[model samples]
Target: MSELCHQAGDARGMEDLMVDYYVDRPFFDELVGLFHERTLAETRAALEGGVEWIFANCYYNSLSAGWSPAIFREVFVPHLRAQVELVHRYGARLDYYDDGKLDASMELIADCGVDVLETCTPPPVGDLDLRRAKARIGAQTTLKGYVDLLWVVKHGTPELVERTVAEAMEIAKPGGGFIIGSSDCFREGTPPENMHSYFQACLNYGVYD
Candidate 1:
């Protein structure tokens, strides 16, 4: 693992400095970086680290409601591709953590040779029809995480959680490549009851037999 020193300042300056520091380092096996002004530098560090893969986190909501693929291509894709290529040189993969409807970015993600994409939200927010996504991306690339954080385990009843998990298993387990996980990172406010219920649901439904 490579450590990235994130200093306090404008994003652009920090990214530039980070890139300068890691462009020729020899200690890390993987490097994770942020997008924005520092994306390019982060990409360079991945190259220096001899990283097998890089992970990126992206989110789209009310604050970024207008986010688009065009914007991603212009501001993020160039560096993302570079980092991915560096990892590929070492026979590695690039995984992105995007927890939103990515209808706009799917094609670009495919073009970048990203090996795994995680946290795909369901309808009302995302366009991931699991069957369709697998068809589009093919067997080479993997899709991870489809559990609903807000509904299946947060506000829903135990019966609802169990049913939802059962459905997910029925749909996603048919394929050998899917991974089950929460839609996003766990939040502190998530009720313990809900958490226990969700896991129990998974335990009861996730078995392949």
Candidate 2:
């Protein structure tokens, strides 16, 4: 779809339409409705199977090649709203994997009624702030992930890793909405001692009152 837009020389139009939905509303609507139906049905099945969380994966925008916030709100929010409603209908918490820079879209996501957010990165490497995000979402949503996988977990010493855990807790833990962990997986070559350090740190410092 994007390549087709590139061929047509209409960047703004492509993003705003978000799929040719503007030009071919009927087909787009039909396909989108089909997806919604299947997703909702599967979600219902999961609920019946005793799952408490309905997870989804969406990596639409990033700090590098992101669309306007307006475009996302107009083009994407409708579908997300419907999915969120479905999850809530089944009494399951809704959260999606957002593996890109979400500093700009966090507010919009919260508006779509997500119960929890995962893989939230921190700045200087990625673009997020734990304390600020906590303040922004308040009790409306839960924020998870933050400890750096590469710099701190893989490369940095165990002490640095411990400090990272302590700091993440200090900032976002006080309010009861943070889950401290790596931004993603600890790489294949990540030191075994580092892995030990991470779990131990979590146990030693992550106690809740």
Candidate 3:
């Protein structure tokens, strides 16, 4: 994907080309803001009808938008803030999903007023360490993440799953602002036993008394 981006950027060399266009703060901000105004109308109305949560499948759009925290803030945050405010106005919550290197941007994202942040992956898969991110964003933002789905779940031992979930809970399940989850989607080939261990560990170790 990165190589394709480079090739397209080099060939087109246009201002609105995918590379520069995605990173262009002003252009995307206005574009997304205006776009959401029309699109969120029905969705916001649905929330008014007694929805509990509004899931902004942002990672859902990350494929086309090509994510970066910088782009997220400049282009997406303003609109995300608006959406969150809208949801809250209707007494609903907004769950923001973005699977990326979020260590630098989680704080900025927290400022956008999302109730929950999805897919907060820890390194060496992503740069986020929930222990640290909890301090930064978890004071207000509820952290929801499935930890290291591929390496730590799909290919891991039951003991590894237990140990890993325990470590994550110890760091994040404090002051009541954490939700255990896979940092990314559980792929098709994942072991069922490991998946069971994950949910079981969350129930066992994710308690806050």
Runs in model 2 deviating more than 4 A are: 1-34, 60-65
Residue 52 in candidate 3, Cα distance off native in Å: 1.8
Evaluate residue 95 in candidate 1 and report its C-alpha lDDT on the 0 to 100 scale.
76
Candidate 3 runs further than 4 Å off: 1-17, 20-31, 60-66
- Deviation (Å) of 182 in candidate 3: 0.9
Clashing residue pairs in candidate 1, if any? none
Which residue runs of candidate 1 sit more than 4 Å off their true CA positions?
1-53, 60-65, 204-209
| lDDT of each residue in 100-173, candidate 3, tens digit only | 66777778778988899878977777678777888887788899985899889999888899999998888887
Instruction: Give per-residue CA lDDT, model 2, range 1-209, as digits (tens).
Output: 11212322133343553555557777555654555566667667888898888776565433324556775666556767777887788788887656567778888888889887867877656788877888898477888888889888899888899888988888888869777777877788888888888999998878787
TM-score of each: 0.69, 0.80, 0.81
Candidate 2 clashes between residue pairs 3 or more apart in a chain or in different chains: none
TM-score of 1: 0.69
Better of 1 and 3 by lDDT: 3
Would you list the rank order by lDDT, best first? 3, 2, 1
Best by lDDT: 3
Per-candidate clashes, comma-separated: 0, 0, 4
* lDDT (tens digit, per residue) of candidate 1 on 24-138: 3221112223332355466557667776667765443111334346645653566556756766777767777777876567657667777877776776556667667666664
lDDT, residue 46, candidate 3: 74
